[model samples]
Target chain A: MGETPPRSANAGTGGIRVAPGHGQPAGASARVAEAPVSTRTPGGGDLGGGGGLPRARAFGAERAFRGLTLAAGTAVLVIIAAIAVFLIAKAVPALRANTANFWTYEGWSPNDTAPEFGIGTLAFGTVLSSALALLIAVPVALGIALYLSHYAPRRLGTALGFLIDLLAAVPSVVFGLWGRDIFVNPVRDFSVWLNTYFGWIPIFGGDGPFGKSIMLGSLVLAIMVLPIITSLSREVFLQTPTANEEAALALGATRWEMIRTAVLPYGRPGIIAAVMLGLGRALGETIALAMTLGITFGISFNLIENGGNTIAANIANAFGEANDTGRGALIASGLVLFTITLIVNITARAIIYRRREFTESAA
Target chain B: MAKRVDASNVTAYYGAFKAIENINLTVEPKTVTALIGPSGCGKSTFLRSINRMHEVLPGARVEGDLTIDGQNIYDRDVDVTAVRRMIGMVFQRPNPFPTMSIYENVVAGLRLNGVRKKSILDEAAENSLRSANLWDEVKGRLGKPGAGLSGGQQQRLCIARTIAVEPQVVLMDEPCSALDPISTLAIEDLMFQLKDKFTIIIVTHNMQQAARVSDRTAFFSIEKTGDPGRLIEYDNTQKIFSNPSHKKTEDYITGRFG
Candidate 1:
């Protein structure tokens, strides 16, 4: 009864750290970090009652170890926090002074010779492009995960899974280059034909000769983010309880039925989390959007006729070319992207928390 | 209560590792047959094979014939789904579905098998819980999640779920191992009542548990000579404990070897 499952490696070795068990009242499993050698009593496991040179040395080593580990972890956390704060500080003045022109005024010519700046188009473009990307990606990504986990043969699934992971790890800039070279040009040719056939439709009419529309930019974005969503979904689906899967199989349910009844319900929390994580990536994405999107400034809702600019792309496009006001405005745009990502992350965690309650109730 | 299971030359394997080999026995119906052994001794694997659960692991292969009533369970044309439905199992850990209500967990199999009417599901769910002796404890919270139950309650609920499927045989792999003494006794007592309607094959590490709940016992040993596991003796529970014919069985029961 006393031999509980050992605390995982991260919790440090055996001074009785708590295992994360179901419904363990918080603080009941509080770990007792080992006492310093000088603090140890004569009756303790280690006999250091005399407390001399060796014991002092041992205590010093313990403090040093903990200090170094904590320092490394804190450093990483601070770096991320610093980046977020810096983005916010630099963008605040511009954000506060952002006139209606900041979001609604379309003419964004940041030249050294003449004064000009506005983001009405960029704000709309960022949200619309990312949303369109998600529309193209989430369902297909979920399907690939389901097929690999439950339907495919073992070897094929394993091999294909590795390939997906490799693709996910590839650099975003690499994907941008590849997307432009392989997909954008060819799709530009095809988009013109599409616009010709469907040009009468408002959604597909009137812009560029070759048709480098928002749809093309979104499609390329979808391709770039596909592997991340698919891999995460696969991991979440795989984490569904082994018992639930077996219990379903024992009930005479078909493979598809079991996934519907058991796997999907269990994976819902993780799937939502995965989508939010992908959205964060999409929000921060710059180079890929810059390349695939034709860098147009007009706010056309039409998906197939005109390319548009996003907040991230506008920052990248303007920062290198402009003077003071343009840099401030670009910094402000970066701030907006950062705030959206933070809100998305916080909301995702909240949703996951609510899901945990639902899961516990259902179980 | 007594029940019988007829397995002839049954062998189960995971790739080159033969998990269980050539286990043949006739377990009388409505009786509890305990399979006792040490860890990795194939008792759990043997219990799983009866319900076709061994196939869950990748590269797992079962050979020879397993039959409950002269119908070879391993026959080439046998429907694996059907075999599993007919033979339900409870695992060592209490694993009630984490996303179903307490009532739903009990009726899960019935609902999934396309039995939709609320009346039918309600009847099945209530009846199974009653049979598992869990109805009173869980009746008040039928709408609550199965995961909300205590460890023992959850185990009983799993039994109730297995009961709902109306399997001809019930196979349990160390069902009480994760529980405390009170919980263990609760399940052991439930197993006794359950045997009146189903053939039960339980694999246990505790020798005293085998003596308490089982009517008959089959002692399975690890496959000797790097082969795999095979049943060393199949006999009445008393005889296996008091006067086993096989030397290995005698040693194991006497605590000389597990």
Candidate 2:
């Protein structure tokens, strides 16, 4: 019998060869001959493998599994690095050809002979619109999340949570179309009402032609991000330990007070992560902003004005008529958007990490 | 500051399933009363009902009469928060708020009741920690997270937090079940001191623990699986342990049956 040789061979074979008589002609003989030998070895003896169990082979399977998973884990970093390299490579040429200061010039004319464009207005618009959207969405999202997780009956919470998740699944294109054809009118009227009354507030102080303005764009963005924040926050809230909540209740806390003391603090990191995820969604949204926003280009704090444009919206609006230099300029803006999101994500992670000691001790 | 707790024909249920049926016990002010029973025997359930904490679960409820110092806690208009405030509880597992510092956790109950003065909170925190026998160990690190303490110390911190609000009655649900023997001894000693200021009700699986610390003992048992728990005997700790009248209580105390 090929006993000793098979033991060494089986070390890397992950026990598949030990399936009695599957494909190997010597399978039964190999098993019978290896039983006594396996019981003498340290690893096999631990499993009491005198009955011809494939102990060495099983050990090999675990190592093989770990190697496979390691590769899968590394693939994500590799792919992200590849994307950053591609973006930088494509963006440099158009940046050199530009006749304007890329960081400070507010106007974009990449298609002209001496292409002149800057990220300044686009960057400001992106940050302003997304910040406004978050301001409008976070409180409402948190309210809905708290209601779903703590206040509603279990069955009702499940059903309503499912509906909110469905809203998240609705395609961005559909949200864009709804903003253009259905939701824009009410937003326009509301914008006019704000201008009529609170015009002193610079954000709400734009004149007529306010239908397709930054206000409309941001409101649409707010609606788009609301479900994302709500669902994520609800999950985090639901995970708050029942023990902590009970401790609060036992200490004479009202229901809301229990939430304030137990649920909110425990879920703070998770909530911040959710908000960042929503912000990421708001920042990257393109078709929705393109369709909803008035496509004028200048920095203005008057949100109801028809003159705000974000990087993503610019890329969508410009890509169609773009020359090679024009394409590079759009990709360059995309790189900037990517960097911004990267910074937002890193900051969120840092906040979560700083609180790791408390969370870990909690577990 | 202690107040008497009276439960008459109190029945608790989880949705349609009855947990404990018609439990009647009176705990005297400033005394340590212990509930002893086997697993699934409703000792913890009965303990929770005393502070109205039983109803915190989604489908859990209590019926019949329960009173604290002649006030019916189950009255329709009685504020549940006030009931809990008057009757504080310590759970089986130590649950110091993970996000709060030691000082903050001790004053959490006070803060909830709208106490914002730092001097008041500091005094309360120090006083409560001292009473719990934890001040000497934790005084230097009051700013540290409460969860950073050892298991025994965390349990003590939880005790401090519970009593910081100066509740009249304190309910402890197997407070030492998770601790080592030394930690258990420390908490048991704290229970003796705590009985001087608050009415304390404790539930324990360790028969010896009930004998050692309780002024009075109540035994709970169920006939079989799925049956609601019933009180078999309640008497002075010495009488219950040495000369229990009920056969079931004797059998349980003597290790004949669970």
Q: Pick the candidate with the highest lDDT.
A: 2
Best by DockQ: 2
lDDT of each: 0.79, 0.90
**Model 1, C-alpha of A153: deviation from truth (Å):** 5.9
- Best-matching candidate per TM-score: 2
What lDDT tens digits, residue by residue, belong to model 2 across residues A185-218? 8988888899999998887886677878888888
Angstrom error of the Cα, residue B16, model 2: value is 2.0
RMSD of 1: 7.3
Q: After superposition, which runs of candidate 1 have C-alpha atoms over 4 Å from their true positions?
A: A1-100, A109-118, A146-159, A189-210, A234-244, A257-268, A358-363, B1-5, B17-19, B37-41, B99-101, B222-225, B238-257
DockQ for each model: 0.37, 0.58
